[model samples]
Target: MKLIYVFFFFCIINQTYGQQKELELIHNCQGRLSGFATVKVIDKRDSSGKQMIGIVQKGALNKPVKVVFNGELTDSLAAFFIDQSANSNPLPLVLILNELFISEAIDNMTEIGRFRLSLRLFIGKQSDQYSEIVAIDSLYTVKGLDVTKKLLRSISEQFCKISQLAAEKQPILDTDAEKYTFKQLHYLDSLEKMKLPMYQTDHPSVGLYKNYKEFKQNTPGVTAELSIEERKNGFRVYIWDEKRKNKTKLPSTGLYAVSDGTTLLRATPLGFFKILKKGGDFYYWRPQVNKSHHSLVPAAYMYGALGGLVYGLIEAASAGNNKWLLQKINYRKGSAAPVSWTTAKEN
Candidate 1:
């Protein structure tokens, strides 16, 4: 009995020790996002699809906000990033919202009949000089203001999702992070050669949406979208249209490989996931998974989603006439910090 107790105690201690290492890694890697920001929402874009000008609405569209890494600090995974060569903004991060705004020709103006939405994040200090964009999304929307409402409602959840992805892509193995000084422009290029793909599964491996428009063209009014890709070291991406029972390949791997490729957004398999009846974003493969469904999300996504849900519920109960319900949090190029060498370990 004494030996058995000693063995269990050691096991528990080891578990806590591993978590502590991760907590400290990201803390030093991100240096804790400096509190500074501004909000901007573009209403229109030019011929080149560049943001023209936007009016800040009432919601969480403001900045200089406080962002928690999903749950407690202990929840943070040990992740590191390359740092900026030059000193720029303290901690620069930007969130962009894109809309397709498809409309019929009115008397003189265009009215939106169908609208497609896309979300991207820019992380870095000298954004112009060095920055990374992570496209985090699930289903494409064709709804109108519901888009904004849903965006607002799920802002915190999205933020948590983003934060968690950033953390997981962090080196599964502990890295000094300091040694990788001098920002490398083609960090993602290494992914193609990094043995197994970042995401753990075979379908909808992490990256970006290459043929989103193509898939949408084939199946208009897509309620939800689930992307799929093989988990080989090469670039192979695909998105499945559940309604049409179709599979289309993306022209290129979706977005740049952010978060070391373990990003929950990229890790989640493509499928129409039903928000589970248990409340919150808890979803499963009941109606949507008839052997066709891929992985909805990884363990990381579920963790972040829970944080988002907790945040969402609070906002719904308390949100009044406020627009900036979302906190202003962002990351920058070479903004990650180095992990302590002594504590670093191989997963």
Candidate 2:
């Protein structure tokens, strides 16, 4: 059929010219920005030193391509913002790069790509004395063979949106913002770190980790009567009472996540999902996001007991105070190292 020929032609075009082995995060802005006085970028991600953001796969026959910045990530992003700010203003700003990920895959004869970006914006008179003005957690999706073109356009849009966000929130920076210098912030962070319960990896307590920090430190916040039940089609989480010998069904309302020593399960309104992959600073959730109930049947066992949930997986990141919650993660099919959970859903 003509449609089959057209699909193969586009696939070949995408393989030959549309998707490159490596993609850069360059922003071709329409005009230079005049919002911030100075733009500084800090690499604060767990994988800050790594330049590779993610991998892209167009088809089964095509080899997965590694997507990295054209140069060093921090330098590249700083230059990107600075280039946008040709004519500066008066607000000194620092942009902390928390997460940057890009992934592409072919599903149902369509090539789907995702860009997951997270940044924390700070502003003040001095770099060290800046206060966080806004946190940008963004997800973008592009379909078809022109993956590179659409991704670049999305990056430009994100850049402009970030500039607009900073300008709009400038009033907060000028008024009630709590400023922290590098020294003060470091001291505070150090104090908080000292307070973490001493962890012995060999002798980790068994139970559900309330967040990623607890799992990383080998400490489970809730250690009482935790058990996972495998049902006919799915599973159920329960807490056993020692005194009464009764099992109470644990609700997923306030529950964020839980880990059974090795595998980390992302808790959701639907059920639990195994976070089996990680790219850059995040963990990848299986089965993608927002798929119907049929999608779960194929990976139901892999999900570790997701009943009939419509929504797929969750992305979790560490927030201070030993807490971790939803955050975007890059998805790749394969077993990954243990630690935390993440997903590629828009938040």
Task: Tell me, by lDDT, which candidate is best.
Answer: 2
lDDT accuracy of residue 180 in candidate 2: 72
Q: Candidates' TM-scores? A: 0.21, 0.54
How would you encode candidate 1's per-residue C-alpha lDDT over 155-229 as one tens digit per residue? 333344554454333221223222221133223323322332212232323223223232112222222344434
Cα lDDT tens digits, model 2, 114-172, are 87777777776644476777877667899974475576557657776676667667535
Rate residue 225 of model 2 by lDDT. 54
Clashing pairs in 2: 315-327, 315-343, 329-343
Q: Positional deviation of 340 in candidate 2, in angstroms?
A: 12
Question: How many backbone clashes does every candidate have?
Answer: 27, 3
| Residue 64 in candidate 2, Cα distance off native in Å | 2.3
Q: After TM-score superposition, what is the CA distance of residue 107 in candidate 1 from its true location, in Å?
A: 34
